[model samples]
Target: MTVFAAEQQFHDAEASLPSHQARLACRAGLAQTTAGVAPGYIQGNLAILPETYAAAFHRFCQLNPKPCPIIGMSDVGDPMIPSLGTDLDIRTDLPRYRVWRDGELVEEPTDITAHWRDDLVAFVIGCSFSFEEALLADDIPIRHIEQKVRVPMYRTNISCAAAGPFAGPMVVSMRPLKPKDAIRAVQITSRFPSVHGAPVHLGLPQSIGIADIDKPDYGDPVRIEPDEVPVFWACGVTPQAVIAAAKVPFAITHAPGLMLVTDLKNKHLAVL
Candidate 1:
């Protein structure tokens, strides 16, 4: 769950986001926006690269279908990711972005103008939030979204297909749910392939190498009721974890939950 209220706003996107607001926020230096800005819209996980590594990264995403599912991309030196939304500018749509150098986190910036390069390319990936929308549509309660807390995310032992310098374990997001609801979610989410289709693992997290249930590598911890076993899904974090480990000379990604809100509606991606 993300606190839509907790996200700090720079300049309102005239009551819209992703296209117009991204440019506005990037211009204002509000790198991190917390709350869900575009209700009922599809938001994305972001990844940016220089020309030298764009080909390799592109191949990496293609090879690792589940963890790095590509949604939209840009040609080298093009800030406009036309595939996602009309006039969508990659450099300024997301509220926050992470700057990496030599595989190390160097800075967290709202805008990357100082770091932008002609060789740079950007990628937008499918997010689990789209699936969560499906679950909610079925009346399955999401604890974090309801309580305004960050969903728990864990680094797993699952390996991703390596392409060039990119290779790392898959990360997953957790949500607590009753067994019946979890089962139904599996059936409902299987239809949307473009938005991270369904839950990868559902019970006994240790089976996947997550030693501690309460501890998470990203996001915050949520309650685990006795009647509710922890349910896990392949997350957008998988790519970020891989990028951080790969340690490319320079790379950028959206801060967790600070998604690239697109004009695309969640219904547009729904298979039903």
Candidate 2:
């Protein structure tokens, strides 16, 4: 199906239900981007690792707050993160998951119940989708969502603070916005630091070592009109890239746009 069709189907299903209801749809294999689903609820990016590497990864998030803000974390061997939601299940809640072995993507599974291990730990990182609602509320247009595609993401030359083997270049997601809107976006997003708040870089993608704006390391590229400048923000996907670079024995993350929806509302995340 086309992106538009998938988005339309999601919209049609999501328009009537509460956040939990929408999540149930996702859990039942409605597997589509969680962009507009559960509009008011906070959406998080998932990262699961074994206890052996959990401490290092936790420190990694703390050291690099911009790209990896910890929203919720699971107790060892537990799939439920009570802080995120009353009935959250990390193994089956997300629409899609990417399983890694020795840092290489081994599978993109719909559920990870079978992969769950006794020493496994799950981390719920804050996502940009939490802030997009604020941007939309302020009438700041997000072109990727408007175009029914995933946000464009690029890997930069900027290195993250190394935590054990969990070190790699920062990954960013881009949105094309005019100067005025970009300025407004900075103010709006900055209020929610729990989610990656504000633009890390604006314009000159090459300065960040992005060789081709048309080719993104992750996600589909969106059009960047001449009148608009590209705004880059720290993305939760950074951990996944770091996992590959670190070559950890095993890991799992949410598929790019398929996020984990939580009961926490976006408004609750704002600091101002």
Candidate 3:
């Protein structure tokens, strides 16, 4: 199905559910971007690794807070992260998962039960979707949601702080907005530091090493009107890039735009 068709189907079937029910739908095999689902609740990016690499990866997140603000973590070998949701199963709660082996994407699975390992550690990173709710509440237009597509994300020239076999260039999500709205977005998103906080770069994509605005490194592209400027925010997808660069033997991450929905309210994450 086309992006619009898939989004419409997801909207009609599950967009308005509460967090727990949204997860239940994912666990039931409904795979699609989690962008507009469970709007008021917090959503997160997933990264699972072996316990042998967990400490370094944890330090990587701490070193590079903007692109890896951790929201929740699972106990080693446990699929449940009760702080995120009592029933949130790391192996099955996300709509889709990307399994990586030696830095290469080996599979995109709807359920990861077959791949779950005893030494695995799951990390939940704060997602831009959590802050998008605030932007929408403030009347800011989110083009990806309006266009029924995943947000455009690109790898930038900016480098992340390296932490023991975990290092890569930063990745950012973009939203095109008119100059005035871009300013408002900065002010609005800055209040939620845990969810990326604010625009990391604006207007000139080339300044950030993005050669073509139409093509993105990850996620789908959206139109950029002449009156609008593309705003970039650090994305949670940085870990996937790091995994590729580090060439870790094994790893699992939520498919771009697909997330783990949590019971925590978005408002609860705001600094203001």
lDDT of 3 by residue, 51-139 (tens): 99999999999999999999999999999999888578999989999999999999999999999999999999999887888999999
For model 1, residues 214-261, the per-residue Cα lDDT tens digits are 899889989888999788888888888888888888899988877787
From the highest TM-score down, the ranking of the candidates is 2, 3, 1
Tens-digit lDDT string for candidate 2 (149-217) = 888999998889999989989999999999999999999999999999988999889999999988998
**Number of clashes found in candidate 1:** 10
* After superposition, candidate 1 runs with Cα above 4 Å error: 1-34
RMSD of each: 6.3, 6.5, 6.8
lDDT of each: 0.81, 0.90, 0.91
Write down the TM-score of every candidate: 0.89, 0.91, 0.91
Ranking by lDDT: 3, 2, 1
Best by lDDT: 3
